[model samples]
Target chain A: MYRQDEVKEASFFDTGEGLVFSYGPQHPGTGHFRLIVRVIGDTVLSAEPDPGFVHRGEEKLCEYKTWITNIPHLERPAILDAAGMLYPYCLAVEKLMGVEPPLRARYIRPIVAELNRIGSHFYYFALYGVFLGLTTPFMWAFGDREFVVDLVQFIGGQRITHSYFVPGGVRNDVPKRVPSGLVKQFRAWYRDATGRSPSSDELTDDFQKYVLRVMEFLDARLDHYWDLMLNNALFMDRTVNVGKLTAEEAAKLGVVGVTLRATGIKRDVRIDEPYDAYGEFKFDVPVRTEGDSYARAVVAFEEMRQSIRIITQAVEGLPDGPVKNKQHPVNIRVPAGEAIARAEAAHGESVYYVRSDGTDRPYRVRMLTASFRNLIVIPYLSRGAKLAEIPAIYWSQNVWPVEWDR
Target chain B: MSESKIGYIVNELKQALGESIKEVKIDKKMTKITVEKDALVRAASVLKGLGFDHVKGVTGIDLIALKPPEDSFEVMYHAGSYSVQELANIIVTIATRIPRNNPEVPSLTSIWPSCEYHERETYEMFGIIFSGHPNLKRLLLPEWWSDAPPLRKDYRPPGR
Candidate 1:
C-alpha cells in the first residue's frame, strides 16, 4: 500500500539475487509461523517453513507437570479439536496404567470426537474461505460450526480446550436427556441451510431418531458446499492443478490428513487402527487421486459427511453403563512400561509414545503431531508454484501452526 | 501365535539377518529388534527389501546416567509400511546403540526418505548426529542457541 520507492529503498533491493520475500510470522494467513520464500520473478524457487515461533517447549514442560494436570496442559496445541488432541495422551496413559475405559465411555467418546472433528473442519473451511477472498463461506461456515461447538459445550463445560478426557474414561456421562429440542433446532437449521428445504422427512421422537435427523440435515448441506466451493469455477481455476503431489511423494514426505488422502492413499487412523468406537462405525474414508489443492478441499468436505454418518451411528449404538473405570484422575499410577496411542486428529494421526517408571508421572513422552509430519512437504510443494499460490496450497492442506510449534 | 502378521515379520527379520541381529522381541503391540551399530544400514536395507517402506518416528534415548556405565546412547527407528495391507499396522523398531561420548549413526533417509525430517528433529532434540542426512539443521530450536539437547536427562530448561 505504500509507495513503490519506499519498498525499493529497503535491504531487499541490494541482495542482487532473485527476490527474497518473508511471508509472516505475523500475517493473517501465517498464524504465528513464518515462511521464508525465495522467489524468482513471480514463481517461488524454495519455501522454508520457519516454525517454532509459538514453540512453548511443551514436551519439556510435560516433565514438570503432574500426570493429572498434564491432561489439560497437553490440549494447548490444537485447541479447536481439543478432544482429538488430548485423546491419544489419555489412551497412552490408560495403556500404561493397565486400565480400560468402560463400554459407555467408548461409544460416547467417538460421538463427541466426531462433533469436534466437524467443528474443526468447519473452522478450516472458514479460514479457507477467508484466504480465497470469499466472504459468504466464511460467514456461512462460522454460523454452521456453532451447532457443533454448542454440542461440545453442553457435554463439557467450556467450548475449546475441553479437558473432558481422563485416564480411565471421559469426564462424565452425556446428560441423561440430550435436550431433544436443541437437536431438532439444529436439524431444522441445517436442513434448510440453502434457504430452501431439501428434505421433507419429519423428525422422530427419541435421541436415536434425533441423531439420524441431524445427519440427514448436514448431508443436505454438503450439496451446497459442492456447488459453492468445490465446483465453483473460480476456486477450480485457482487450485485445481496447483500444488500437485504424487502418492509416492506423499508417502515419502509422510504427509497426512486431506493432504495424503488427496494423493490417493486411503490410510486414516480410524480405518487402520480402529480405536475407540471407530470399529463399530460404518463410514468411508474420502480420498481423491488428483493430489491438488482442489482435491484436498473436496476430501475435507466429504470427510465432514463421513464424520456425520459416524456420529449418527455412534449415538444410535450408545450403550448404557458407567462412563469411567475405577481409576480416579487424581490418584493414579502407571506401571513401568512403554505404550503408543494413535488418534485421528483434525489434521492427521496424532500419535503419542509414553514411557512410565511405575510412578504417577510420565518419564518420557514424545508427541508426533500431524503438522510437523506435513511440514516437510511445504518446501517441496511450494517449490515451483507462484508466490500467490503459497497460501492456497498450504491452507488447503489444513496446516495448523500451533500443532506444528508444539 | 506364529500366524499373526506381526509375528511373521519378526520371524522374517530374524531369518534374513541372523548373524547381525543381536536380539529380537515381540509384544502384542510392536516388534523390537536390536542390531550392531555398524550393521544398522544393512538391517534397514533388509527391512526395505521386505516392504517396510516408511519411517514413522526416530527416537534417541540417552542411557548415559540412567543405567550402568557401559550403557550407551540408544537410537530406535520405528519403521512401518503404508502400502502393504499386511504390514501396515506393524511398527518395527530397529534399535542400535553407540558410545555416549560420540553418538553417530548412518541416516535412514537413504532407505526411507520420510526419516529426513524425523532425523533432523532427533538430531536437534538429542544432539545425536545422523551422518548422511542431507540438510541436517536445527529444526525446532533457534539457530544461535547452542545449548544442551533439551530432551536429554541432564539438561534442564533455564530457570528450572
Candidate 2:
C-alpha cells in the first residue's frame, strides 16, 4: 500500500542525503520481516528492523488460555521447533505446580527434542541455500529433513507444530517398534522398488534402530553437504570476513545460539544449566572464533552432529518408568509464586517467566525467545555493511520474525 | 553447586546496595533483589561490575487490579553472565516498583546495552516509560496504537 510519494515524505526514512528503501516483507531472506536501510552509494549507513507483520500478542493470549490449552498457541511462534518453544514453558509450569516427571519421560523428552533440533538445523540449511541461490542443496537439505520429521511423527503424531509436550511430562510413551500393518506395507513397497523381498534382519522396524539408521544416513550426508556448500569457493567469498561481529560486540549485544557461539563464547543453556535429561547426556558445545557468516554456518552444522550424538545416547540409555505424572490432573492449578525456566532451543536460549496467583490460568507469562534477543544485531551490524552483504548477514543471524514479534 | 553461586551473588548485592535494597529472596533456582526505585541504576551498575554483563529479559508486572490494588508497576531486569563461569548458571533479578499513575524508571540500557530492545518492548506493552531510554517508541505494536497499553490488566482484549 506504500506509494513512492508517501515514502519520500516520511520523516523516519529521511536520512538527510542518503537514499532509503525497504528490503523486504515478502523476500525469502527477510522471513516476513522488512529492514529499512539508508544507504550512501553502496554502503549501508543505517538499518531499522521493522518486524511485527505476524504479531499475534502471544503473551496476552496466554492469559486467556488455561494450562493445558496454552501449549498449542505458545508453540506457534517457532513452529519449526515447537517442542523447543514448549520445553521451557512446561518446565516453568511444572515448577509452579510442584510436580516432576518420571525418569523415562525425562530421557524421552531430549530424544524427541534433539530430533527436532536436527530437523530445525536441516531446515535452516535449506533456507540458507535459498538465500545464496543454490538449488541443489536446497532440495537435498529439505529431502534429508524428512527422515527426521518422520521420526518425530512416529512419536509426536504430526509432522510439525507437535503439541506433544505437557506440563508434568510428555503426552504418552514412546512406541518401541513400528506397527505391523505399516511394517508389511513398507516391505511390500521395498519389494516393488528393489525387485526383491526384504529380509527380516536387513531392515529392522524398531524405533531406536530406525532413529539410529537416520542418524547414520545424515552423518554421511553432512560430509557431502560440506563438499556441496560449506567448502565451495563461492560461499567462502560471499561469507568470510563479511558482517564480522567480534566477541566483545556480540557479548554486548547479547546474541545467542550459533550467532554467539561463532564469536567464541561458550555460553549454552543446555550446558550451563542442564534442564530435563540434558544432564544425563554427553555432547560438546561447538564454538567458532571467526564471528562471520561462514563461522555461523559451521557452528550450526557442527551442532546438528552433536544433536545426533545426544539422540543416540538418550535412546540407548532410556530408563524404564512411567511416562507422565498421573497424580497431576489436566486442569492443574499453579501456586502463588513465580518461576523462570530457560532452555537451549534449536535457535538459542528461550527464557520463560511465569507468575501464578493460585489459578489455572497464569497471571503473566513472559517469553524472551532467542530470536527476540538476536533482533538487536540487525540494526547494529548493518550500519556499515555492503549492500550485497545484507542478505548474508541477515540469514546468518537466524532471527525468526514471528518469534521475535510475539 | 547452584546454592553457593546464589549465596555469593546475594552477599555481593547486600554489600553493594545495603539499605537501598528493599528485600532479597534466595532460592535454589534463582536470586531476587528488590531495590527502591531511586536505587535501580546503582543496583544494576553494581551487578554489572560483578560480571552480570547482559540481561536475559526485562519484564513488567501490572498490579493495579490486585485485591488491595497495589497501584504500582513492577519492572524486573533478569540479568546473567557469560564471562564468569561460576555466575553462568545463575540469573539474578533486579526489580523496582514505580507508581502506576506516573510510571517512570531509569533505563538500564546505559548499564547493559542488551536491555535496549527489552526495555522498549516493556515500555510499549505496559506504558511504563523508561525516562532515559534512547529509543522508547513502539517496537511491536502498530504505529496507530492509541488505546491503553495492551498488557495492563484493565486493558481488555476485544470480545473479552
Top candidate, metric DockQ: 2
Q: TM-score of predicted model 2?
A: 0.94
Which 10 consecutive residues of model 2 chain A have the lowest summed lDDT? A1-10
Cα displacement (Å) at residue A145, model 2: 0.9
Q: What is the per-residue lDDT of model 2 for residues A1-406, given as tens digits with 9 covering 90 to 100? A: 1123423223344457898899887855635888898887777777788887889999999888888889999999988888889999999988877788888889989988888888888888888877878768888888778777877888988888888899888998887886556555555544543456646775587877656655666777788889888999988898898778888878777788899999999998888999888988899999999999999999999999999999989988989988898855568777878888899889899999988877788889999999999998877777667788888888888768888888
What is chain B's TM-score across the candidates, in the order shown? Answer: 0.90, 0.95
* Candidate 1 whole-model C-alpha lDDT, 0 to 1: 0.78
Best candidate (score: TM-score): 2
Pairs that collide, model 2 = none
DockQ for all models: 0.34, 0.50
Tell me the tens digit of each residue's lDDT in model 1 across A228-274: 78888988888999889898878767778899899998888888878
User: Each candidate: fraction of true contacts kept?
Assistant: 0.33, 0.46
Q: TM-scores for chain A, candidates in order?
A: 0.91, 0.91
Local distance difference test, per candidate?
Answer: 0.78, 0.84
